[model samples]
Target: MTGTIENMIVKLTGWLSRHSIDVLRVSLGLVFVAFGTLKYFPGVSPAEALSVATLEKLSLGTVSGYAAQFVIASMEVFIGLTLVTGKLLKTGLVVMTGAMAGFFAPYVLFFTDLFPGAPTLEAQYIFKDIVLAAAAMVIGARALGARLIPAYERQAPVHEIRERVAA
Candidate 1:
């Protein structure tokens, strides 16, 4: 019974190791695409004002208003498409690094707004980016050829194992 349970656990973990990164990448891509699509419509995205404000501050007033939103939206959509399609993924990861910096900049530029005592709604929104950023990092590592290997599988040649593993 113990051996059967261990085999089941190993198989489940092996399946997760093989597919989790791609799932993370696709899910992150969907999030970006959804948020970016919201930005295309004025007053639709909850982050619209904050995003525009941050862009203005970051660009030193050179990029503002609709133009700032457009640029942000375009960049996000491009990143999303690349990640989702698994094409130009390296470029997407590169762009994602820059976009993540921009996403976190509001913490520096509008510290008061984000934390006016307790955390504001906007602060909550920005905080969620931490998970997104981490997910992107995992996806980026995979894009660069990093992989998650199950310990049992790593112990010996996979073909030598009798248990069938899901790819």
Candidate 2:
């Protein structure tokens, strides 16, 4: 029984080892970039989607809304591109994770309570943010070298196999 469990565990580890973080990076990157684009540009579609009158009455439609959207967009794009490229992968992940956390605060506090039908909306957003942040943490670990092995790795061989020269 113990042997069987050991074998199973080994198989599981092997399977996990075979997989790379690249897939996760791609997925997360695409999501961030696309969402950022929508938030940033917001153009006609978003304007239509929003409660224009309510937004206008709140003074959110004029300046703050557009400015906030741009900031959100810029961050998203930066994070997404960095994630995809694995550029300063660890550092970027940490920074982006922080930004995402900041972005999550308002939804959890102000917006969540405003919804009559779903007073828990902000909580849900916070939960999702937590999950995303966890993912980012995982990605960041690889960059910081605390993890046993980095995800989505393209590692060099352990030793140089020099060819023997004939006399």
Candidate 3:
């Protein structure tokens, strides 16, 4: 019984470890494609107003309205296609990182409105960019054959964790 359980656990971990990156990539791709498609139909996307407002504020009101939304939608679609197809993945991650940065920038610019006691609707919508950015980082690192964990964390030994736990 013990051996069977151990084998099953090991297989599960192996399967998950192997497929985790693909799962992240595909899910992110799906989200981007769905949201981007929604932007094409006016009044379909909940973020339309927030997007326009953020761009307007970012560009001092010069870059707002339908044009900005169209550009963002195009970008998202391109990123999604590239990600889903696993073609030009690095490029996709780069574009995704940039877009996420822009999406979240207004949070900082309008800190009081966004981060008071509770986040407003727009703030709540854009806050998910943090997770998207982190996911992009993970995918980017995998694309570049690099470690997702920082060098400091990588350098720490298993013994250190055991010692800390013992303490």
Candidate 4:
């Protein structure tokens, strides 16, 4: 029974290892598209106000209100479409990196608004970006030819191991 369970576990993990990156990429894309679409409508997105405020501040008051929201929405949708199509992914990742910086700027710029002596709802929203950022890193690594090697495939060749030991 133990052997059978172990075999099942291995198979499940193997499947996950093979498909996890693609799944993550597409899921992140969908999330971006959904949230970006929300920003196209006023008062629809929970992050709209904060996002507009952040953009306004970041742009030195040059961009504000609907214009700021439009810029954010357009960028996110572009990233989403690239990720979803698996085309121009490198470009998408590059844009995503910049967008991530903007996304994180609020922590430094609005610490009090987000904290307010305790974690507010906006803080929780921003905190979730940590996960998004991590997921993006994994996807980015995959895009750059990095991969998750299964444990069985991670062992060095015997000769290589022996050579290292001799050295």
- TM-score for each candidate, following the candidate numbering: 0.92, 0.60, 0.79, 0.86
Kindly indicate the candidate among 3 and 4 with the higher lDDT: 4
lDDT of prediction 4: 0.89
Would you give me the overall lDDT of model 3? 0.77
lDDT of 1 at 1: 84
Q: Candidate 4, which segments miss by more than 4 Å at Cα? A: 1-7, 156-167
Q: Which portions of model 1 miss their true places by more than 4 Å?
A: 157-167
Q: Summarize candidate 4's per-residue lDDT along 52-94 as a digit string, tens digits.
A: 9999999999999999999999999989988898999999999
| Candidate RMSDs in order | 2.2, 8.5, 7.1, 5.8
Q: Write the per-residue lDDT of candidate 2 for residues 122-166, one digit (tens) a residue.
A: 445445657677777766765676444422133423231111111
Q: Is candidate 1 or candidate 2 better by TM-score?
A: 1
Question: Which stretches of candidate 2 lie above 4 Å from their native place?
Answer: 1-12, 43-63, 111-117, 120-126, 148-167
Residue-wise C-alpha lDDT for candidate 1, range 1-167, written one tens digit per residue: 87777778878887899898888898899899999999999999999999999999999999999999999999999999888889999999999999999999999999998999999999899999999999998998898889898877778776855554432
Better of 1 and 2 by lDDT: 1
Highest lDDT scorer: 1
